[model samples]
Target: MSLGDEHDGASAGGGGTGQTRTRLPDSGAGDVYGVYGGARRPARNSRSLITVVGVVVLLIAAIAFANRSGDGDGDGSSSDAPAGRAAAPTAATGVKPVAGKNGTIPSGYAHDEQGAQSAAANYAVALGSDGMFRQDSRHAIVRAVHDPAVVDGLLGRLDTAYSGAFLKNVGLNEDGSAPDGLTFVSRTVPVGTKVTEQTGDAATVEVWCTGLVGLAGEGSTKPVTETWFTLTQKLKWTGNDWKIESSSQKEGPTPVNGDNRASTADEIAGAVAGYGGFTYAR
Candidate 1:
């Protein structure tokens, strides 16, 4: 996520972060694709709607192309050529998954396409977590997942991005905590991952995720809400592992919302407390 000056602004500012309007999904609808943080300007105009549709179409096409199976290639290696089409992005590369961690972030990712994809997914979860709002946790996460060259700059920018005012806007105290008798909920669950581009030394991967942000409690104005976005990370092999070189986010390849009742704040809090985050792998 690009870090913007404004709290609602995802990571960075400018043309890519999206608009500044808020629209609650119809609880009756199916999976809601939401852009978390900042104000997202709703696409009321025809041109804006068209642009969103175009983006959705392109993203879907890219994902489909990435996931397509090889054409009777005996070996399912990702490096294998698939005739006229693009290489299958998520095809297994027969590499071992990393089995280690540096602090909370997974370490030792395989130095291949699968490893890159895996690194992207796990990093997505960390970057989107509530921990990112806390100074210590944010530093650990940045050090764990980001390339050494950019870590210092990223930490400085992020520290400013999640400043006191921003935290207040999102219903947290100055130190990224709920006042009392409330639970702060900011989590990202990656549904799946794709390697949009790859090489021996670098890769660009997209992680489709559903996230929970906001607070949960009695009379909480910023009630926990879910968001949908595809986080694209440009990763490089560094110190024998995949580390984030750069990252950006965009609103969804979101599916149509389904008919499901929205959970109450208490129920949401309970469920969150009962669950644990996963260590994702390709």
Candidate 2:
């Protein structure tokens, strides 16, 4: 899709304030993709029903499983009481981490819809970052952000995408390295999040985001371009924590931007490396 399409309702901003003047085409309520503000109808494929059923089954299973795990009361005794009663306090008690403990990453996300939003936002930031462009850092970033079940698959594809030849195509050095005196930048800033559906133990959150990606060097071919995307995450409360189960992303609800002076390569690089990333709380 075109970067500035109005139908998708995506907007671009000069800075991180998230102000946008454009309006998106309206689709009536209850439309799936309409959540993003587009009129385009979803495909009338046979898989739609199957997909819905599968999601329902999964949700049911997750809720049941989470409920069956009795609350910790020192002595392990099972309770058949309403699952909601037990799950509520556990999910509610955890405080969202305000600052990163050891580094830039935020910690202490509460195990609820808010925590799911936090994870989705931060995960989006990690996924769209420059770290995904290098080999070792790419693996670290993916492992840190993705759900365990899909980590292997995601890592394999990421490895291929950031392979030596691919970096060359993107004007990087043969070893998937950046040229001297240049810094490549990639970062995603989350705009907002909405909990589409939520239960005591599970939640689905949509994180709208804007991303900057490109090389920053003198005479660079693609000097810092911008794009928008929304990340949808399914989160489950596991091991007394909230963890992402799976996530999918799509192109923007973007708007146009006013002209602004671009920062120098060294400046952008220094900011990225120097400034720490936040651990988000919804």
Candidate 3:
């Protein structure tokens, strides 16, 4: 529920900036085509971005606003293509084979557009993870994923804010560990990513993610639940890796809730422990 408070660096100071699932009511048999009505309308508009994003590990709708891909304002032109056929916006275009490793997280990204994107996706998982709840792990993660220039600034602020009342509020001990028989669930699964803006030295990337947060186990009041979010990270190419300069998040373009039954607490805990998470950037 509370993965703690937001760290958006606006009032705290500056710099912050989806892949998103779209839910359309099942039109049953009444669905119509090309009439701007029915569940199929968005299907026509978002095919290019949605398909590409799902494969690349992003819903990338966050940047669609810039290119006006589906917005009916275009003269019906795609760059370097014939008129009347809208081209895929360049921002949603991405590179593949994320080649890098950094301990638990991926590091050593190339100094290019693809590398910047990979960096942003991986960082989103780390920032939203259970590791951020613990002081030691949080410190290491902050140092590992952040730009060296801003690391101290973030630590100085985050370290103070992440302690005491917050942990207890989330049902964790003051030291950041869960109580006996309970497991804290805080994992971010990236659905899609987009390179909103890129340059030789810096990049702004958005990662669309679905997360599970809460306590899983018997007699727990905070049951595990799902949330959808988008994380925008500003990355700098430094030390041969793309490191985060600043990041922020917002609630998502959530999909309709599914019909699947909720799992029991023990079942959730077992599944979480038995299953390993993904290396999202690649």
**Model 2 lDDT per residue over 1-282, tens place:** 111221122222110111111112231112121111232223342446677788789999987876676343332112222233232322322343444421334544565555666666776565555555566765675555444565565455445434455455455686656788677665677887766767777776677887665567677764555666776766666655555565555566766443335578667777767986644533
* lDDT (C-alpha) at residue 47 in model 1: 45
**lDDT (0 to 1) per candidate:** 0.62, 0.51, 0.59
Q: Candidate 2's error at 69, in angstroms?
A: 38
Best by lDDT: 1
State the lDDT of candidate 1 residue by residue for 1-282, as single tens digits: 222222223343110121111222332212111215422223332346677788789999977765564434332335532245443434434655566879867788776666777788887777667676677877787788877887766566566655676566666788977879888776777777767677678887778877777778778876776667777777889899888776666677766543345688899889878997766535
TM-score computed on alpha carbons, candidate 2: 0.59
Best-first order by lDDT: 1, 3, 2
Which sequence of candidate numbers ranks them by TM-score, best first? 1, 3, 2
Q: Could you estimate the TM-score for every candidate?
A: 0.72, 0.59, 0.68
Give the alpha carbon lDDT tens digit for every residue of 1-282 in model 3.
112123334222111211111121232312110001112111123347666657455435556555564344322111231323323333323444445556678777757655666678777677667776676777777787888887666665555555466556566798879999999887777777767767668887777777777779999877777767677777888887888776656567578664346789999999889987766544
RMSD of each: 8.9, 16.3, 12.7
Better of 1 and 3 by lDDT: 1
* CA error at residue 271 for candidate 1, angstroms: 0.6
